[model samples]
Target: MHQDFPESRLQQLLPELIAFRRDLHAHPETAFQERRTAAKIAEWLGRLPGMTLRTGVAETGIVATLAADKPGPCLAFRTDMDALPMEDRCGQPHASTHPGVAHACGHDGHVACLLGAATLMAAEPERLAGPVRFLFQPAEEGGGGARVMIEQGALEDPRPVAIFGLHGWPSLPAGTVGLRSGPVMASTDNIDLTVHGRGAHAAYPNRGVDPIVAAAHIVTALQTVVSRHRDPLEPAVVTIGSFHAGTARNIIPDTAELHGTLRTLSEKQRRASRAAIRQVVEQTAAAFGARAELQLEEGYPVNVNDPGIKAYVERVAVEQLGRERVVDGIPVSMGGEDFAYYVQQVPGCFWRLGVAPADGSPGVESLHNACFDFNDEAIGTGVRVHCGVAWSWTRKGQLC
Candidate 1:
């Protein structure tokens, strides 16, 4: 840890932080509809003196800025404030109060950690050499909130030289942090395909071209994009999650619609997979005596971490939590993150903070699971790491 980190003050503040996290978890919101969540965050940050608060940015997003008497380069930390549309099966008292909405992805804990950092930093303004911006982003679950916030100038007017963010990982034990250099997450693309064919009665043998048959062939052929078209070493996924066809068995439907997602780690691979999919769908449909239409909806790009920033974060984590708790060169994940948008505009690093059970126990639930909850024991560790990085950067300057 940096010599200036106030360990005693952090211990004193941990209880309130945990309670705040639980409260957010109990009353969860999803996507751009985080009005209550934003209000709660704003209320908490408003208590601290000398903090500039901006509300309603990008609709249900908030940005809080804190500066010191001394002048230096500004740094930013972002926390997502959206929940998933799933049931809360954790069975805890602080579990979700809303039906079909839960904080299963740990965004609540993220908000608490950022708030804790802001509180501690606010108390010791003399220690800061520059301003620190806290971004409360909304709609990270497929809503593209980060892109909208950037368009509205969340990164401007004392723009940060570098930004940082973190997500809770259940695979690692508490107090440990995972760091990787490049391509930490994959790019996401939504695919919608419609196979068109002639409709006819069941008794008529040659009256109609059955699109269901063509759609089935298309689904089977799409796998070839990943298995044969792309290199075996490269990672890619082509899943047809939804398939809809005729309502009754006796009638041949005119069309069949298929919806799915495509994931790739590199832009080159993304392009190759897309082309392969289109070719397979078109040719397969033509062979079945039917026509098809394909549409691709682009999503978040691959999240690439800045090498220098990753190194800086690793150094800070090792100092604060010891070398044993810091895991370097963790494998890249196929999951997607909107934080990728922020890094495209400025140098940034997004890492994983361990959140599994502190005790050595079995049956740890993975993220996005209904029973998964953010472990409170990891909040202090996250706060310490975030504060360490922000303080070290503001005082010592950029590493790269």
Candidate 2:
């Protein structure tokens, strides 16, 4: 590894980094609506010499490839650029400028981190042997931005042998890197259950089929998919996140809908649990004299790691960010991510970059919360970690 380059350079670029992030944070964009954000990023990336810019591959997504004079394997580093529909409560100077649209998911910080890496690669061109692909993806907040990019040929051409991406987590310290070898995140799928019941007057006790009653049954029984059908050792979660029933208590509504997500770390569990839920919802609703309409939407897949690439990430985190802050083999999370789509196509590893409070005064605020913001100080460290991994993975000779 090259030791002459210093992290001090990151401080010099901080003014622009912080400004870019805040400006984008203020004018937050939702999935597929990141035209301004995409333009801003493309403008910044274009300033860097020797990098070929490619935009509009997947609906406002931007990809820039940096090639070295010498040839080696290609490695891609990705960052999701999108905002959630939460309000900004961080109260920081760079707080969300948009109303009702906030960067509560720490995506703003992820973009800054990848940009930091790009600056470093630009500075130390001679040291990098293989090519580095910088992916500033859009629609990561909820839309399937990652899926679109891959489908549009981001991973093709050089066809990166290994891809690496990271999520900003608030559970760990500001500069800590949380890594796992396999099944790091759970698969997420959304199913909406609409129960068709006959509407009738509330005064008549036996006039109509009570959809509220049927919905209660469906909700309660779906939980059994995890407790009864799945193994105890294996991780599984089926949560009914939303339910909309009768509009007025006096009148029994004809239709009631139940919406929720199913999370699992294993593919077998995902398939089995989903099938079980469908059957249970249909059967349970049918018994109550109501027909069921179910719509299951596919979401992020399980974030699994490549054994070879995962080992390299550990080494990079320790050397760049320090060993004390680099955690290994943390328990997997139930949250789903579209990054799984990319991992499915190639050998890759997805890890969490922790940015939570260490003193316990202001502890972690789970992602998608309005108060969440990525620790800006950690941006430089993120760059070092990515470069270190790229070098280790694509270098001709390194720790094996």
TM-scores for all candidates? 0.96, 0.95
**Model 2 residue 233 lDDT?**
83
Pairs of residues clashing in candidate 2: 26-97
**Whole-model lDDT, model 1:** 0.91
| Tens-digit per-residue lDDT, 155-255, candidate 1 | 98788888999999999888999999989999999999999999988778379999999999999999999999998888999999999999888999999
The 0-to-1 C-alpha lDDT of every candidate, in the order given, reads 0.91, 0.82
Residue 303 of candidate 1: its Cα lDDT? 91
Q: Which ten residues in a row have the lowest lDDT in candidate 2?
A: 391-400
* lDDT over C-alpha atoms for residue 312 of model 2: 80
Residues 211-270 of candidate 2 have per-residue lDDT tens digits of 888999999998899889888888998999888988777898898988998899998888
Give the residue spans of candidate 1 off by over 4 A: 1-3, 68-70, 394-400
Which candidate leads in lDDT? 1
